[model samples]
Target: MYLLILGLLMALLKFLEFGFLAEVSWWWVLVPFGLAALWWVWADSSGYTKRKAAEKIEQKKRDRIEKHRESLGLHKRRH
Candidate 1:
């Protein structure tokens, strides 16, 4: 995400001919975007995306259960 954001910012700056970025080649300005794409590919292939999605789904399930218990006037028992 950070890489994506940075790449976009640099691209915008270069496009607008801002300061040092004005002298930068389009290829250089686009390097960050390429890097961001590579990072995403690596992350996806390594199962990071799947793990995070699973964790998010598990959290939602836990929240739903807790809300249902509360609505039914149930209390959590101590272990």
Candidate 2:
């Protein structure tokens, strides 16, 4: 997935001339490249977003449980 995205980005960058999209006789090619770029960004960002969100939730739960245990002055002992 990453490879394909990188490839498309490279292609688009190569196609651009002087910081502008090259005027291609066939315009339809631009559509796929644009879509690919959008997909790549969305895919990359969503994974990190989900991971961070999950970590935040887990940490909150852990903190709450720890606070509860501390208030009770209880801990598990291994002997």
Candidate 3:
């Protein structure tokens, strides 16, 4: 995501003839996008994305359970 944003910014700067960026090659300016795509491919193949998604779901479940427990006066609030 960061890489994609960086790539877009670089491309924009290059297109607009911004000072230093205008002097850079198109290949250099487009590298971040390639990196971002590679990152996505690696994350998907390594199950990183799936694990992160599962972690989010688990956190939501825990939060819901804690809320229910607190409502029932069975959970203590952290100081």
Candidate 4:
């Protein structure tokens, strides 16, 4: 995600010929996107993406339970 964002920013800057970016080749401008693609491929093959998604869901569940607990004065709220 971060790499994709960086690639977009670089593309925008290159398209606008902003400063030094104007002199960079198209290949260089596209490197971040390529890296992002490669990262996605590796993550998917390794189950990294699924694990991260599961972790996020778990965190949301925990937050919701903590909020309910705090509302009911059942337990101390975590930071």
Among these predictions, the greatest lDDT belongs to 3
Give the higher-TM-score candidate: 2 or 4: 4
All candidates' lDDT scores?
0.93, 0.67, 0.97, 0.96
Instruction: Write the residue-wise lDDT of candidate 3 on 14-77 in tens digits.
Output: 9999989999999999999999999999999999999999999999999999999989999976
Worst window of 10 by summed lDDT in candidate 3 = 69-78
Q: For candidate 3, report its TM-score.
A: 0.94
For candidate 1, the per-residue lDDT at 33 reads 87
Estimate, for each residue in 1-79, the C-alpha lDDT of model 1 and write its tens digit: 9888999999899989999999989999888889999999999999999999999999999999999998998958789
Candidate 3 backbone clash number: 0
Q: Given candidate 4, what's the lDDT at residue 16?
A: 100
For candidate 1, give the lDDT of residue 1: 90
Candidate 4 structure, TM-score to reference:
0.78
Q: Scored by Cα lDDT, where does model 1 land?
A: 0.93
Error of 2 at 45 (Å): 5.2
Candidate 4 per-residue lDDT over residues 47-79, each given as its tens digit: 999999999999999999988988899986469
Provide the global lDDT of candidate 2 against the true structure: 0.67
Error of 4 at 2 (Å): 1.5
Q: Write down the worst ten-residue block by lDDT for model 4.
A: 69-78
In angstroms, what RMSD does candidate 2 have relative to the true structure? Answer: 7.9
Clashing pairs in 3: none
